[model samples]
Target: MANFTLKVTRLGFSLLQSVSPRIAGKAAFRLFCMTPSSAPKGEKAKVAHAAGIAKLAGAERFTLALQGGGKAYAYRLNGGAIGRRARYLVTHGWGSSSVYMADIIETLAATGAEVIAVDFPGHGGAKGRALHMGMAVKAIAAAERRFGAFDAAIGHSFGGAALMVAAAGMLPSVPVVLPEKLVLIGSPSEMHWLFKDFGKMIGLRRAAQQALEKEVHRITGRRLEEFDASAAAGVIKRPVMIVHAEDDKEVSADHARRYAAAGESVQLHWANGFGHRRIVAAPPVLETITEFLTGDDSVREAEIVPLFDLPARRMSL
Candidate 1:
């Protein structure tokens, strides 16, 4: 059914491209930003279970009023310590909700740090059918304002890119101050790559693609290329850990390399076996992330290592 729907969508866009490429491009861009109604792969049950994991871990579930008209669902997990510890923010990828990051949030909480996980608008418990980077940035800002400033943050895929863009204070709608430490897992280097990839997937023509870019510019008040995570990392003088799997089919490893090259304090950690989605929950990846956030910063940024003790060659920039 999905394949058939995709085919029909492609045909409709193709016809629209023939008549008015600008209209087709605008339509295609909207399709690109559409959020999933249910969890990815139709794992609605699993997502539900993950959502309850936070509550089971004694997290205080709350809803944050966003700057816009929507509200974001968030889970605040207290650290296992008595006094105040480092606070952390965890965000999930596109087509996913904050429930998916429940494990990571719990793990951070166990480390005696307050952990807050927020679902972007149009995802998780948030009500909407559309979402964009600007919406995500505002969600993060709203979360920060409701809760307190976080000492560190971790994000996967689209969430990571949004975190970077927000931290860089690029978007005018939500001027945000993100955590000093960040970990981006399987995230794209630039928004332009995502725009191009979506266009290719939908079989958009050149004119449609140009129109899509123009529409994005009109919405964000900046070119799509301007929303580069590498550029965000370059300007922020904070420690950033870029974790990517060599075999990740969704996002290329080159994005991780670009981040490492652009940021002076950025470290790249390669993982094996764990693909784009699984890397968020991979034990080694989580362990390395914990170490980066809580442990001493003794690891050298130049020398890259495999997060797992697999028989993989060391990757370097």
Candidate 2:
């Protein structure tokens, strides 16, 4: 009862954080960082601590060339406490770096999974490259070459779109290279929609949106018909989980609905207002993720973890 009260207090305070977007983002981030951790269940804590220590030791930052294209880059975080591992790859979205995905990586790692989280072409250490889905597909392939076949793939937003293309048979082995499951966080059903929405956020006129769409075509070679998630979703054979925030002002809940409607093996879970990026590290988000990756497919919306691990959340910094 005390623990529940503390969580509620923390969340209520979190809600009272500054209203300015920038300040609010920073405050929420700080809250996630400075918040005291609840003692993990004995086994869970051991797993997490062991994984953190080993991750510190086994961490390898490396680069690989995309077969015929340029080089791709990523970091590998191995739970040093374990020998072999079930593999998982996580991809990050625009405006955010791979640093945000570390929380999820550590949680899964503590469970004895080998984890690789990649920065997109223009994000994280992947700067100096253009943002294109094909480039992201190559990055996933390059990571596979270095890390071996993965048991799962979880991508947030734009990164999810990249993996979606890879799952749709753009990679060398197509669905074979795809892990047993694909998880998307606040992911979009259409790349064009994302571009237009982003345009509006930054004050782009309709004319500008149309012009940008032309550039998207020139760069990605994806026609308007091919822009929909349905194009690639049909080829994905593995189970998929869509995680989104119910009150997100950025990516709407409709994105999840569209994905669930079009995907062959798909699950959707809605959460509190963690928005587009914060949702990445939120506890409810991770629970849905852990459930899917571990094959506990009976994940009802209520099963989502309401509280987060503060230490893992701080690792983002």
Candidate 3:
């Protein structure tokens, strides 16, 4: 039934494209920005459990008022160390919340760097049904204003792209201070690829595709191709660590290569076995990231570590 509904909807959109590409494009854009609702009982229980654990661990919770009349919920886990603290921020990908990044956040915090994890709009406790790259940038800006500058930031998938776009100063309206270092995992390298992929999935005509591109520019103040993470990496002169799995089925490992090719400051690490999502929680990956964020500059340029040689542990996911 769901597949049939989707097919019928696509056919209707195709027919609408024949009649008016502008209208079809507008509708397609809305659908594209719609955030998935992952509020099943098990998912809710998991989020609740994580929230409970966070509170038990003495994590500080706060909210930031967005510029566009919405709220962003964030978690601040104080570093375990007693002296000066390094500030770190973590953002999750599409359809995921800060809760999903709990492992990474906890690992960074354990390294004695104060970690802040944000739940993007329409995910976690944030309110809204629609989200886009521009909105994600604004959320990051809001977090920065609430909690000064970050020494480093780690983002996975969509969140990684948002961090690059914001740090690169691609969105003029929302200026952001680039983090001293960045860690991107399984993230898309270009925004236009997403648009083209979506177009192909929905069978959008060229006219509708063009119209959708115009709508993106009108809202984000940049063309779809302009939100390129590889280009953004060039603009950001800071160190970047890209960790990707060769077996990642969602985002190609080629995206990681593009980031490394952007500049000398970017390092690429290819982990075996772990796919798109599990890579975030893998123990070896965590160890490497912790070292990169807290270790010396020399560690930033180290070659990829062979995952099979490392001791395997059960994943939390």
Candidate 4:
């Protein structure tokens, strides 16, 4: 992890040399669009995405690709229009689009609940130089407009972080009538840690990491230290469900604990085999998430170490 941080740190101003100023401004933007896939990004992502696409049927189709949250770009996957009660709002992580969350959307739809999954700004179809708290809510509102309102909220990685922020943080708070139950998958309890870790994975050094922090402060207008998910977790009044894989190589299971520690209302579930993406589709996970959406709190606490039956490597830049 230290080495990864060093790489990103190494990339600081000197790394910027490889790209133009126009590109550096957009580098973070491009990074956000990369999504979380185990395969090599770029061509491999396109291929893997094709496989994910091939699996879709019925209302599971990822359609209406467009910019959302008033950002430069965003994508929306409709789980076939809104139903009367308890809609499901799905959001994806950094560099990802609405496509990957299709299974969860479909599973939610199968339950007769409306599902609207959106790709946040700087990812998928959403357009923005970068993702901000303001834009995240915009994507949430965009889904609400069409799907009526979500009774539950689900997100992965960065999306998971955004889910908490959208539910508890953000301006105006999007009217309480939207999503009441929140689900975060593989997202850290602290934003600063998340960014710091992300920088490490991409080869950032301490100094470079500081530069990254500076950039974060400059762009988002908030101190990186202040963006603590645990603090944010405190403000969320509704039930927050946290799901993490024991074998997850990226975000550690400790992150899940952080969320649970933040508030009494938070619930943590440690899954056995399903990694980050597949967890959203696993029937057992689906059962757990669906139950949570229905306001069931049957999940019991267990040793988080058991989750890592298989050790996986962390994210590679």
Candidate 5:
């Protein structure tokens, strides 16, 4: 069934690419940015896992309406400690809701720090079927407004890219207070790579791919090169921990290397066999993330091991 869906999607893209570059670009934009109305595979198990975490952590649900339109859903877990610990903000990847990040949120809250997990526009119970990086930045800003400043942030995949965009001050309308510590998991460092990959998958020519990038620049006011997360990591002056699975078929491990290479404060942890989605729920990865968020500056540097050096392990998302 999944293979059939993939073949159909590829065929549709190939047909669009054969049209004009502009047509292909428009279609790609919609397909990449919009969330489908139907739930993804394993959605039920994901939802159940998240619900269990929320219940265990005593999380409170809330909603924030954006200025332009659309609503963002969030779950807040208050700290149990006597005095306030640092506040942490967590967000899931594209096509996923905050529920998928419940385990991480619950763990952070267990450490006596208040935590908030947000579902971007068009995700979870949020209003809209389309979501862009701009909308995601605005949603994060809205969460901050509702629940004070966050000292640390943890993001997976596209959500991590959104954090970099927010920190770069690209979303001018929605001012963001960049968190002191950041953890990016299975994130793509360069936006152009994603565009190119999509183009190749859709059988688009180089010209058509360029057209798609141009469309992205027209909408976001930033070129594909300008939106690179590695560049953002270089200038952000904050401690960063990049966690990438060597087996992550979605985003390459080179992204982690790029971010870590950008600055001395950036640390890269090479994980094995977690693939893309499963990495988020891995216990060891979770432990490392929590320690980095609470630990001292020493945690900012680590050795990067090759994918072959790590042992293989099977885990479900």
Candidate 6:
């Protein structure tokens, strides 16, 4: 039944392309931002994981009211009133919640630094039915306002792009504090490519693509070309680590390479077989991210660990 519904929807959009490309483009934009999957199963497991991490890290969970409307769900681990080492902000990708990033949050918390993870608007417990890159940036800015400045930030997929956009000062009216270090996992380098891909998927033609881009520009006041993460990387002074799996299956590994090529400070880490979502929970990948964030040289000095040699675990994404 689900497959049938999906087919009908796809067919309808395809037909719309022939009749009105402009309308098709608008529909494509809506579909692009919509979360296709239902809420993840294993509700008890997700709760258990969150509870265990909170206990281990001495974390607190709460909600913060968004500026315009709605609310964002967030968790803070370690560093209470007394404060701690460094502070790190973490965010998840589209259609994902902060619970999926529990492993990363737990690991960061273990370092004695305050770690914050948030479910962007429309995902997790946050309010709203639709979300865009701009809103994600705004959510991050709100998190920062409540939690204070961050020494480093780690973002996965769309969340990663928001971090780059924030660092580039592209988010309107939102005050942003650029983190000293950044980690982008399986993130796209160019927003235009994403829009174009969506156009192709929905059978939209050149005119339709232009219409979609213009719609986005209406909201963001920036053209598709202006949303490039590579450009952001060039202007931002912080060191960036771009991690992508060789077989991402979603965003191409070429995006990571493009980011690495953007500047001397950008570093690329290649993982094999981790794919898109699994890369975030891979043990070695986690270790590398932790080491990079904490500035630990021991992990690298010990040996070059082969990816996928470690056991894979189920994550919330």
Off by over 4 Å in 2: 1-58, 79-84, 170-177, 197-211, 299-305, 308-317
Q: Cα lDDT for residue 8, model 6?
A: 82
lDDT tens string, model 1, 103-171? 677678778788888888788777788888877888889888987788998989988988898899888
Best by lDDT: 3
How many clashing pairs per prediction, in order?
A: 0, 0, 0, 29, 0, 0
Residue runs of model 5 more than 4 Å from their true location after superposition: 1-20, 37-40, 43-57, 79-83, 303-317
Off-target runs (Cα >4 Å) in candidate 4 are 1-12, 15-48, 54-83, 127-134, 170-178, 197-211, 298-317
lDDT of 2 at 82: 47
Give Cα distance to truth, residue 3, candidate 4, Å. 13
**Per-residue lDDT of model 6, residues 27-116, tens digit only:** 777876765342665876467456545553555777877667667888887757484579999988877777777788888888888899
What value of lDDT does candidate 3 attain over all alpha carbons? 0.81
After TM-score superposition, the amount by which residue 22's alpha carbon in candidate 6 deviates from its true location, in angstroms, is: 3.7
Off by over 4 Å in 3: 40-57, 79-83, 299-317
Pairs of residues clashing in candidate 3: none
Report every candidate's CA lDDT. 0.79, 0.63, 0.81, 0.61, 0.77, 0.76
Q: Rank the candidates by lDDT, best first.
A: 3, 1, 5, 6, 2, 4
User: How many clashes show up in model 3?
Assistant: 0
Task: Report the C-alpha lDDT of model 2 over 1-317, residue by residue, as the tens digit.
Answer: 26676566445434443233333333332322231222334674456545543544556777766655666567776634446668899887754556656778777777778788876655556645344666677788788887788888988887887777777754343232577788888777776555544444433344444554555455445553475654566457577788876656666677777877775467777765576667877876786688778868765343243464232110111
Better of 2 and 4 by TM-score: 4
**True-structure RMSD for candidate 6:** 4.0
**Candidate with more favorable, higher lDDT: 1 or 5:** 1
- Of the two candidates 4 and 5, the one with more favorable lDDT, higher being better, is 5
Candidate order (TM-score): 3, 1, 6, 5, 4, 2
Please, what is the TM-score per model? Answer: 0.89, 0.69, 0.89, 0.72, 0.85, 0.85
For candidate 3, write residues 188-260 as lDDT tens digits. Answer: 8887877887887788999998998888998888888888888789778999999887778788878888998
Number of the candidate with higher lDDT, 2 or 6: 6
